[model samples]
Target: MTRIAACQLAPVPDGLAANAELTADAVREALAQGADVVILPQLVTTGGVLEDAEQARAVAVASGHGVFAAWAAACTARQGSVVVGGFCEAGDDGQLYNSAAVVDATGLRAVYRCAHLWDRERVVFAAGSAPPPVVDTAHGRIGVLVNYDLRFPEWTRTAALAGADLLAVPVAWPAAQPGEGGGPDGQLVAAATARLERVAVACADRSGPGWTAGSCIVSASGQLLAAAGPGRSAAWADVDPEASRDKLVAGSSDLWLDRRPELYDRLTAPRSTSG
Candidate 1:
């Protein structure tokens, strides 16, 4: 069983130094709790919802930023431990991207940029063209996805197909308004995604004004193992990543073997105006 911790934190806007320490501390704390994998909220190094592209560019850091080195140092406390967190990335191509990095004792392992932008994010970030990366780690094959990317089934399916045992999601979900049904709760969406792909999922959400503090860990069977309560906290759970390899859901119902990919051509086709 691999222990996972989803840390929900309130990052200080534009305070790189402060948020760096905040995330590094969270990693150490989660590691102390025997967590093999620690997941942090989106834009953890820089609070979410930037004003414009210029402001985002000002705060964005390359994947090689020292903040990740801090996280790597924290992971060194526990051998083979892993950390996944989001940040504003200053891409080598001179564009800003909302990206996440996977780090372990060895240092930064992989980086995944958010592909599906949300609302104002489109104006601040350039959507990534590459699919979510599945990193091979000592704990397991970990996949990553930023906020808004979770809403696309095809994207998550692509990760599962790439042999990701667990999906670590970093999000800053917007809070629902009074008298408004907040579509589907982020936690519920995480659970549903796990159930659909037969993969475990850990979502670390941010807290603050206009955000939902929803952090949770779900099993491959879609069980809500642990969830953080009100305010800043961490949700802990022990999941069997190996169990996800077994695609057999029931007697003869094999999740992967029953796929109908040939009929999914329209999934990538342009949307039709008239049904």
Candidate 2:
């Protein structure tokens, strides 16, 4: 069983130093609770709000250096727990990306650039064109999805099809508007996705003034295992990676074996509009 920790942080807007410190504190706190892996909210290292794309690009850092070095050190000290979190990444092509990384005692294991951009994000960040690789870790085969990626069924399904037992999501989810469901959109989607994909999912979301703070850990069967309510908190859960591999829905209804992929060619075809 893999014990996972999801951290809900309320970052100080535009305060990088304070955010890093807060992140470290959360990591330590999660570790103290016996977490095998810790996941933090999107852009927790440098806070989510930025003046413009220029500011975001300027603050982006390379993996395994600076802020990442500190996070890696924290994981190394724990000697086992893998830490996954989001940040402003300086890509190899000199562009900026909203990215997430997985770190363990061995060092940086995987990095994922958010493929789906949300609202203002498209103006400040470049969307990733490819799916992130599934990482083989001590706990399980881990995959990463960013904030808006959760809205795309194909994204998570792709990860699960690639044998990812766990999906770690780092998000800065906004609260439901005045007349909405009074619950964050992330909550329902996370649960639904986990149920459909049969993969254990952990989402770490930022909590603050206008955010919903809907961080949660879901079992392979889509059960809400743990949740961090409306404040800065940590949610923990124990999951068996192998359990997700079972594609059985009932007596003889298997998820994977019953696939009819041959008829799914249209899924990849571009749509045409009527003139």
Best by TM-score: 1
Best by lDDT: 1
Error of 2 at 133 (Å): 2.5
Model 1 C-alpha lDDT per residue in residues 1-275, reported as the tens digit of each score: 89999998988989889999999999999999899999999999988569999888878999889999999999999989999999999999999999999999999999999999989899999999899999999999999999889989999999999999999999887776221333228888888999999999999988777777778899998998987755758889999989889998689998898899999998999989896
Q: Report clash pairs, candidate 1.
A: none
lDDT of each: 0.90, 0.84
Encode model 2's per-residue lDDT on 1-275: one tens digit a residue: 99999999987766777777888788877887788889999988778676678888767777755566667777765656888999888888888889998887667888899999988888888898889668888889889999999989989999999998999999988775321444566777888999999999999998887777888899998998987778548888999999889898899999998989999887788777762
Judged by whole-model lDDT over C-alpha atoms, candidate 2 comes out at 0.84
Regions of model 1 farther than 4 Å from truth: 177-184, 273-275
Error of 2 at 170 (Å): 0.2
lDDT of 1: 0.90
